[model samples]
Target: MIFPEGGGRESHRKEEIKQYYRSFLWSLVFTVPVFLIAMIFMYIPGIKHALDTKLVNMLSIGAILRWVLSTPVQFIVGRRFYTGSYKALRHGSANMDVLIALGTNAAYFYSVYSVLRAASSTDFESTDFFETSSMLISFILLGKYLEVLAKGKTSDAIAKLMNLTPGTAILLTLDDEGNVISEEEIDSRLIQRNDVIKIVPGAKAASDGFVIWGQSHVNESMITGEARPVAKRKGDTVIGGTVNENGVLHIKATRVGSESALSQIVRLVESAQMAKAPVQKFADRISKYFVPLVIILSISTWLAWFLAGKFHGYPDSWIPKSMDSFQLALQFGISVMVIACPCALGLATPTAVMVGTGVGASQGILIKGGQALESAHKVNCLVFDKTGTLTIGKPVVVNTRLLKNMVLRDFYELIAAAEVNSEHPLAKAIVEYAKKFREDEENPMWPEAQDFQSITGHGVKAIVRNKEVIVGNKSLMLEHNIPISIDAEEMLAETEGMAQTGILVSIDREVTGVLAISDPLKPGAHEVISILKSMKVRSIMVTGDNSGTANSIAKEVGIETVIAEAKPEQKAEKVKELQAAGYIVAMVGDGINDSPALVAADVGMAIGAGTDIAIEAADIVLMKSNLEDVITAIDLSRKTFSRIRLNYIWALGYNLLGIPIAGGVLFPGTGFRLPPWIAGAAMAASSVSVVVCSLLLKNYRRPKMLEHLDIGGIKIE
Candidate 1:
């Protein structure tokens, strides 16, 4: 029933269309009987003989009855075409509505004229005239009804999206004794930030927030398109409209009402559905000249035939046939107008986009709109943020080197004491490593450390076990006048070559040991790079990490190009540089610092785990933070565009082939002329074909990737 195609809503739409058809049928039932009764009275022997055998003399009863019955039917069924024609005339454009309005009105006025003429002629009959008026009106009404039904079906996607958001929110309040009180509320405005909201299993989340207490598994497939339910725990954020599978969570609401994720998604889908694609613009241009051309052609057809008749010297006796020829020309012109509805042309692109977006949503990818989806298909270069995009973004100690014959426990204890007070991410990594090693029974904690001071761009220094302990890079050791041995220098060089950071540990003016820390590459990172390579898309990595670490991770992920040690703004500049090189770039990242870069790229895709600022800055948001969705998004866009192109071709081709035939272009050569009913049927078939083609998208499947590919070429571990 829905214009474009999909299954679930089809039944409901068919029923609605049936209801409209039933109403139209009842209207026909009432009007057709009256029309027949009026015809009988005007044409019967008794009535005809009483009126001096003249049909026109019986007009007082038949014409009045016909006008009374047809007036309301015309208003009910013909008003849409009338108003549409008026608008088209106002704008100096012609469309299908103009044809319906002209055809139906001509038939009605012709019937009135015939009735008047019949009253003055002794042998005339009203039967021939009344039937034409009734038939034309019925045909036009049927076409209008079909048009309404098709339009309703095509726009159902937006309605389905709007139905996802909940109508009410649960407000949590505190009583005098500080005990919580929950109330089911209808107003979203009553919900505020930091309020504990209880969402039951199988119910949609009222707002976007983080879980404060309890645990549950939420089905975010509505937003992410992942069929599996994601396990939620404390500190994890939950999106609105996602179903809660089990358990109850007291969520501290972070976003409410229109600010919720569900509201934003609904707004995006609605706007995307309303936006037109490139092909529709062509149809609009064609429509602008359609009416004027038809009028000129119809007039010329009448004049050409009349001129030929005069040239043959038979015009005096053939004048009535010339009028009939003009009427036939007018009928053909009207048919052309009525049969060339632009609804299919206009809907071609939007319907494909809507279906593509819905498919992407079901797969955990969120493309902002048709524009973003379209642009993604054209992306030739894909730039990625290194830390969170390729690497795990969490540093771990990968190697340890002893410089002064210090025991492993003693080295770790001293370093842990020195780094425990530091707030840097790398410092925390070292502290955590030391904590795990110190937990062993053989390793004991050192005495309390004091006077901790962190050196910017270097490392930290502190008094551990009553000794001045330094834990930093070689620069920090030299700054404190601590000597580095030849062995320590060799270790640093080897670690640096492997894309690892070396934290130099020195105590009492002597080098002790070094800790090599590096972030591990994410699983399947290399495969994603190879896939891009096969697709002919260039892959590059930008990172704030040192060049050594950047090159190391880049090599591991099969990335040949790397931009190292870039600040947030510098990352955006890199995107601009890529654009200047004439490559359409798609930036992918999941960090706050990547927001500017994301905005600078032609298409920005943010991973779901990314900060809100970064997600907001990007054009597309990937809910699973999986690289596979990037490829899936591009494929979906390409397939959607291809489908639209196919549908547009089919719709335009049908009109192109049928219109000339309908206009009698082939009559002289092949003796073929398209009847009005045949033209109408063909036009309907074209619309239906476009809808069916769009619906076929439901069967489209994502491409499958081969498993168990080796990554040794990139050296990823």
Candidate 2:
């Protein structure tokens, strides 16, 4: 029932056919005893003697009764194969169902006619009446039942995903001072944009919306592939199907129905299922030739046996056994068809991808699809954006250099007062530093800043306490006709050598002191680079900052390659350059400027808590902003692809060894033949093996760095 009348109609049809086969299995159970009774009348000597002595004239009546009961059983329970074979033959193609329907019905009608003709003959035996038809029908039904169960296991992932969408929604109406009012309860479709929907604790959200008020943690694992619940506040987006951990939220719907992120995720997953893997193409090519070859060989086998009987000096007495030879050939051909099913070949790649994606979700790494997961394993080079990807993107005061005959605290106060109205990150750093060093009497009672002006890429100027205060770079000082003294130049050179942004402070047209500000590297950034080195991934940094600052941070993180002073378009070009050099590059960043580069890379991994543009452009978005997930994602892809290969080998290898044995290749010289029941059982065993192989992938162990390294030489302190 997981498949219904919709876009996935083919999947639904396949399930319906499987269920029909299961019903035939139940019919086979009921008909076994009837088959045994017919066999007893023909083979047992006592029963045959009694039938010949007392009811010899009634044999025609008995044959008619057998025909009446068994015809419905064959046509009704076995009608599925008959219809399928008819369709295949009409299209000039033959498959396993064609062989089963033709072989079994031929054996049945042959026995029926033989029994009826023998009623007039004086010397007649019913041995041929009971042997062929019952065996073929029983075996084919068994094979079909097992095939259904295995195919069900292969498609479990899609069924589980469909179960995520909730069946109902709660529509909010109105709230009085101390009372609640309820409107008419309606379906999810009636909910419109900007409508307030009340989500109870532990219930799945019905639509994509933003929280108007209240707080809770929502589990967005099904949509974003993250297992942990993310905390939501007012103005934060919530996706449908995610569970609310606690607290009620009055959410205003942003996207309803198919436009929601949850719906897009479901659509993506379903599309992945429809894609055929490379191994299935091989099976399709092989099947194109397999059916015709089997049919020709079966005809040749019958002709060879019939001609040999004629050449051996046997007369009309050899006619019965010659007919038996043709029946045997038909039986072998049917067995070959049933045992060579393509279930494993089709399931190999998709099952591994489904499980791999699920495992990645638990670790907070979101992979878009099978292609992305496959390509991630082969990435050789990693390029990074500098502002938010490498550095923390927050400028801070790193050092304070006092000029000759200048006080450090006074220098900080003047700079802070001059930048009081500035909004740049650099300005905030100076103000925060002044606040940290503030003293009761040391606080400057400067007049309110006036005519504040900011020079792009330089600094700010303001009139403080009626004195012109300049806090800017060297260029800003020269533009204002303020001369930098010998002491100020010496201090600026020292700050530049330390890879710091030098902010010159001048009061009343004279240089006072220098303030150095720079964006600090993120914590554990160096360790992340070292880990990438251990994994053999080449790391490079690209930035819009000056060459000195770029190289300074790159050296701290142990990265040797740096692209300095790059604009947004230039950063994307650098990614293309790395890719042109035969490297599968991955760009990691967290800013609007990095969007183009993120889209151009082989794998775009966005650090969480970044700009919305960067996150949208990335293929795999890291929810925790931890660099370690890059290694985790690559390791996951490698393991997943390895499993897919193993499954394909096992599935194809089993059919290669099975089809020949089912064709009676060992029959002529050694008088050996594969019984139909054994062929049915072997087919079931092969299907079970494929399912078990897929399930074993759930136990794959993700590689950990600590397990393979010695950290004793690296001091943790």
Candidate maximizing TM-score: 1
RMSD of every candidate to native, in Å, equals: 7.6, 8.3
Question: What is the TM-score of candidate 1?
Answer: 0.74
Candidate 2: deviation at residue 377, Å?
Answer: 4.4
Cα error, residue 447 of model 2, in Å, equals 23
lDDT (10s digit) by residue, model 1, range 1-717: 111222334556677678558656855864675556554554777764553332345444555556667766556655666888899789877877776566556556665675676567765544323433454555545554675565554445456545566766666665767466655665555677777777878888877899876799999877766666889988889997788999987688998766777666666655565566555667678667765665565445445544554565233443333134444444455455545655567657777776777667656677787778878888999999876577666789988888677678777888887787775557778877887765664344556889989764467888888788888777677777777888888888788788887778888767878789987776678888898889899999986665676787788889999887677888899999999999999999887778889999999999876777878888788887767677777788888888988988887787677666666567556656554545555665666667667767756676565234333343211
TM-score of each: 0.74, 0.68
Instruction: Give the runs in model 2 whose Cα sits over 4 Å from its true position.
Output: 1-18, 29-31, 34-74, 82-189, 198-204, 219-229, 246-248, 297-323, 351-370, 377-626, 668-671, 704-717
- Which residue ranges in model 1 land beyond 4 Å of their true spot? 1-54, 57-73, 91-96, 106-115, 118-190, 199-204, 294-323, 392-517, 669-672, 706-717
Compared with the true structure, the alpha-carbon lDDT of candidate 1 equals 0.70
In order, candidate lDDTs are 0.70, 0.68
Best model per lDDT: 1
